[model samples]
Target: MEFFSQSLAEALSMILSMDQKLYAIIWLSLYVSFFATLFAAILGVPAGFGLAVASFKGKRAVITLVNTLLALPTVVIGLFAYAFLSRSGSLGFLGWLYTPKAIIIGQVILILPWVISLTLTAVSRIDLRYRRTALTLGATAFFASLAVLREARFGILAAVIAAFGRAIAEIGIAMMLGGNIKGFTRTMTTAMALEHNKGEFVLAVALGLVLLLVSLGMNILLQLAQGRYGERV
Candidate 1:
């Protein structure tokens, strides 16, 4: 009990002091996760829309592959990325290994399937009549898709928020590919792991608190957005 109390006090102090290194780690985590989610959304949203609306051979197979990738281990992604980014690898000329960019790349891969799968689910759940109505109105294919998306916007936003949450909380890819460098690649999860391994409980606990707060804030925002727009869909 005494040890717990002491550690809590120390953690509070660290958070109150606004440690510069800790802020850097937090900022990097947010930046990388944002870009990763953004990239995933760009590709995933269109792919998901096509999957929901278009007919083609092997579409089921494609969806099955995406579902399988949704469960892919982050460490596997890290290893795959490392192989391509390492000095002797084919794409080594890019020199991204052990960098924040490398971490973002890995995270994007990890979350892309989630975004696609969830977006597809959202689009699929929309009423088929909605699409037909738009088509009957002489809407172009692009406009029809846009109308469908707007109707299902809340669910699609939820999918994106979920992907962002997953990317930000992930540690395996960040640690393995980013090398957990103090000022550069270190994220909240990675920093917590490093600090705990070094027997530095305060920073770890403080970071954990910050991570919790971030997650809570995201959830609140998601709920608010859903409440405001969910019924319109």
Candidate 2:
């Protein structure tokens, strides 16, 4: 009890003092997660929209595969990414191994399926008649697609939030692909793990506390956005 209290007090001090190293870790975590989510959204949403709207052979198989991949473990992704990014691998020429970019790549792969599946759900729920209505009004197929996307915007936002949350909190990708390099690729989760391994209890606790706060704050913001969106709609 006494030890926990002491650790908590030190954590408060670290936060209040604006510990540069701590902030740097936090910033890198957010940076990688944000860009990863962005890239994933770009790739995933369109695929999802296509899955929702287009018809083709093996469509059910593809959808089932995507839904299954949504539950793929971060560690498995890390291993596969590492294998591909290593010097002997096909993508090795890009030389992304053990770097922030590597972690970003892993994160993008990790979240994309979930984004796609969620997006498919969102777009699928919209009545197909809307597309017919728009096309009947002389709108291009592109414009009709846009109408569906706009209506499904909130669901897409939710998907992004969920992806971002997962990316930020995940330790496996950061540790394995980023190599947890200090001041360069280290993230909150990796830092916490490193501190714990090194027996730096106070700093580990601090990082954990901050990670929790970050996750909580993001969720609160999401709820507020949903509220505002609801009112507007």
Candidate 3:
């Protein structure tokens, strides 16, 4: 108990004092996660929107595949990325292994399915009237789809928030791809693991607190957005 208390106090102090290493780790984690989320959003949103609106052969199979990918383990993604990025791998000429780019690649793979699946669900739930109404009013097919998307904005936002949470919290991709290089690729999760392994608890504890706060903040935002969406509906 005494050891725990002492470690907690030090951890709090490290956070309050604005420790540079701690901040650096936090920044890298957010940096990697933000880009991963952004890239995933850019591709996933359109793919999901199209999946929801378009009718075609094999559509159900495609959605089933995407849904299956949602449960893909992070380490699997890391290993998959590692193969292509490694020295002897096909794309090894790029020398991206053990870098932020590598981690971002793995993280994007981790969250893309989440964004796509959730966004598809959100858009699928929208009333058919929205698209029909827009089209009847002479809106182009593209514009009509946009109109429907606007109505499902809140759900999409929730999907994005959830993807960001997943990206920031994952450890396997960060550790395997980034190699936990300090001041470069070391992220919150990787740093925490390293600190704990070294029998140092202060930084790890501090990162845990920050991670919890980030997750809490995201959930609060999701709830608020959902509540507002309910009211709007």
Candidate 4:
């Protein structure tokens, strides 16, 4: 009990003192997750939007594929990434394995489905009247989509925030793709795992706190967005 209390105090000190190492790991975590979310949004949002609005064959199959990907385990994703990024693997000439870029790639792949699925749902729920009204005003289908997207912006933002939360807290992909290299690819989740394995609790506790705070903040935003939009997420 005494040791737990003392260690907790020490962990608080680590956070209060602005520990450079701790902050650096947090920054790296944020950097990787941020870019991962950006890439996912860039690709997923449009793909989702198109799927929601366009009349195309095989669309249901594509949506099912994206939904299925969301169920993939993080380690499975890490392994798949390794196969592509490993030196002996095809396209390995890019040398992305065990790097922050690799971590970003894995995280993007990990969360892309979440973003796409949610965004597609959001856009799909918008009343067709909006699209018809826009068309009646001589707006193109693409521009009409922009209006529907605007109307559903809150739900889409929530999806993005949710993706960021998932990416920031993931460990398996970061560990395998990033190698948890200190001062580089190391992120909060990976660092916490490493520290715990070494029987060092303070840094791990601190990182866990940060991860919790991030998750809390994201959930709060999501709730607010959902409440305002009155949409199911």
How high a TM-score does candidate 3 get?
0.97
TM-score of each: 0.95, 0.95, 0.97, 0.96
> How much lDDT does each candidate structure score?
0.90, 0.89, 0.93, 0.91
Q: Candidate 2 vs candidate 3: which has greater lDDT?
A: 3
Q: Say which prediction, candidate 1 or candidate 3, comes out ahead on TM-score.
A: 3
Sorted on lDDT, best first, the list reads: 3, 4, 1, 2
lDDT of 3 by residue, 112-149 (tens): 99999989988888987889888998999989988888
Clashing pairs in 2: none
TM-score of 1: 0.95
**Per-candidate clashes, comma-separated:** 0, 0, 0, 0
Q: Which one is best on TM-score?
A: 3
1 versus 3: better lDDT goes to: 3
Total clashes in model 1, counting residue pairs 3 or more apart in sequence or in different chains: 0
Model 3: lDDT equals 0.93
What is candidate 1's CA lDDT for residue 37?
A: 95
Better of 3 and 4 by lDDT: 3
* Candidate 2, lDDT over the whole model: 0.89
Best by lDDT: 3
Per-residue lDDT of 204 in model 2 = 82
| lDDT per residue as tens, model 4, 170-194 | 8999999999999988999989999
